[model samples]
Target: MSFNFYKWLQEQDDIIKKGVLFICDSLFVDCNFKGYYIEDNNLIGNVLAPQYETLKQYKELNPYTNTEHIRYFFELTKAGIKHVATVLSYERSKDTMQVCLEEQYEYITIENGVVEMTNFEPLTVLIKEKFKL
Candidate 1:
């Protein structure tokens, strides 16, 4: 069967749609998703074009959103960004995977906030390009 955003979005519950929007909005307001595919029981692989935004925008968009049930949608969005969403969503200062402080990493957290990336350098060119660094 063919896929469409409007049609697929319609199939999701309200919370899922909201979750999708919230995640996308944080990434940037102008995300262009080409399509969605599947892996195991979860949805995977949507060709997306996300415009770069300032760290202030990222901070403003991402609060400590207590998304317990709707986490799957966030996970889907995170996957789209190759898990940069996970780094962005790390609120705790003590997380094991959290390599450094927000102060150390401009735009990596809310405080040192700017569009320029001085922290959490990705290993690959694609991930760097994804974040628009």
Candidate 2:
């Protein structure tokens, strides 16, 4: 199947949120305060670690911001952030995603992809909105 960045992000977010809830429930049942944060580390190591590495690999392959993979990853991250915010009951903000996109664009060379420099700004804004960031 084609790489669906937004879908991947949503799936990741769902997994993380469910994991968090499970951890929270476990803590509550066990009355273990110290263990409250324990699951987070495990989750990060087991789940996020691999995904992070995959993103890094994509970055390495592209080596520039404008590649299709880079853009896909960027959009995915924004979706992830939005999912996190929604789960946490916080209003989603696109500021962080925008900053990241801008930074990515800076390192992008003409060989990366067909996207234009001027297009980056608006794309960031659109991604944020698309993800409810």
Candidate 3:
């Protein structure tokens, strides 16, 4: 997570940099909120949430300048942000690393139907039950 966070920092736009920095700090250092709890302690939770005031502040801002993780990057700064909060699996095979938001009210689910045509990776989803806050 540290490596990925550092990589993202160097590549992100200057405007979004602060939001990205805050998220990185919260995730890698000061985690003050609980988003969710999962099996084996794997947590996928909220990292940032947009405020009505911030919405006005960002309304005049330009769109993200890059495409990598583009959808999430913008969502994090101007709207609601969610992420993989923690992974406590020991065997390395006990992590699900995902949460479906199809019925969740806090999220706006986008189904482009593009990835539906891809093949399966024979991966393991070990969580017996997923909990959201």
Candidate 4:
């Protein structure tokens, strides 16, 4: 199964989709994903992206949220990227990984916040070009 952004996104719950949008928005604002992935499931004091300084504050701001749940989705996205790179024989590096995520986010933006593919070329083509596949 190849990576299909819209299909993968449709499988997520609403909260997780919102979390991903938050991540994309953060990246768009500052081009930084410094602490998006959480290894220990500890987001309370951890700086997750630039906008939300801490998960505690994020929760306070957005009451109907589970930080851990959102973190899980974040990890899933990261793992999916790693899997794509491996399957496509692309060298896994920080820069390349960031590019993959950025391109996907840009695709979402181009779709007017929808997870459809309309304005851009097939995602595989863009990613293949990056990987030289």
Candidate 5:
């Protein structure tokens, strides 16, 4: 039987997806911070909002102030970039990687003596074969 690597990887636990996004974002940030030109800084965040939301909620519930930001920080380190590259290699070798878009929005309203409106475009997964990394 021919194995479908992309499907298999997608079926892996949510950690895999989260880890991938985190690493991607970290790498982008590191590159930009080092004065490298980046086309879109929000690309990773937009694609991975769902996963990020999950991780954020998890941290929020746990509520440890100092450690709480660790996840965010992790997504922007050299180690994070290396990890992302590794995962992408695995994903590409299997030929089951694609870029997806997730449309996200925030409401503008007045609350707690402040008015705010924000919009987010998150990254997502699509059913396809291979991505240029």
Candidate 6:
């Protein structure tokens, strides 16, 4: 079955919507994405990581202007952020990278949506460090 991002997004709770947007904005700025678009039921984009020679060089040249994107993700769970989000890349298909939140006061359920495009090495590092992944 084909996925419908807009339909799925509208069905989600407010916090999940916010988190998805947060991730998109973070990737656009941090990873130097050309732009975002929906394709085959997935949000798709390309990152500029391949243009750089080395991860260190990428890190040196691009310092995070704002830590709130990364910071807010870490606080999502604590602050009662609910739902599940998966951050994936073309290169790391085997790795299931997730930042989980909550749903229902009695118990929490994690849901998956979105697909990370390209190999955002530097941005991945920042997210890993922030989320302690």
Top candidate on lDDT is 4
Cα deviation in Å at residue 12, candidate 4? 9.0
Tens-place lDDT per residue, model 5, 63-108, is: 4322201111122234243211111213223322222211221222
All candidates' TM-scores? 0.20, 0.20, 0.17, 0.24, 0.18, 0.21
Error of 2 at 49 (Å): 23
Error of 6 at 14 (Å): 4.1
Residue 28 lDDT (model 2): 32
Candidate 5: pairs in clash: 26-75, 46-121, 46-122, 46-123, 47-122, 47-123, 48-123
Cα lDDT tens digits, model 4, 43-126, are 357553334434444445555432222222222232134312110111111111112333352222222333322222233443
Among all candidates shown, the one with the greatest TM-score: 4
Model 2 C-alpha lDDT per residue in residues 1-133, reported as the tens digit of each score: 1134323433443333343334334323211111111112212245231233244344344343332221122213321242211111111221122222323222222222222333233333433444444
Location of the lowest summed lDDT over 10 successive residues in candidate 2: 30-39
For candidate 5, the per-residue lDDT at 28 reads: 45
State residue 115's C-alpha deviation in candidate 5, in Å: 43
Q: Which stretches of candidate 2 lie over 4 Å from their true place?
A: 1-3, 29-133
Candidate 2 — number of clashing residue pairs?
0
Tens digits of per-residue lDDT, candidate 1, 1-133, equal 1123223323432423343344445545333332222111232456242322222332244333332111121222234443322222222221212221112222223233221222333222323344453
lDDT of each: 0.29, 0.28, 0.24, 0.30, 0.26, 0.30
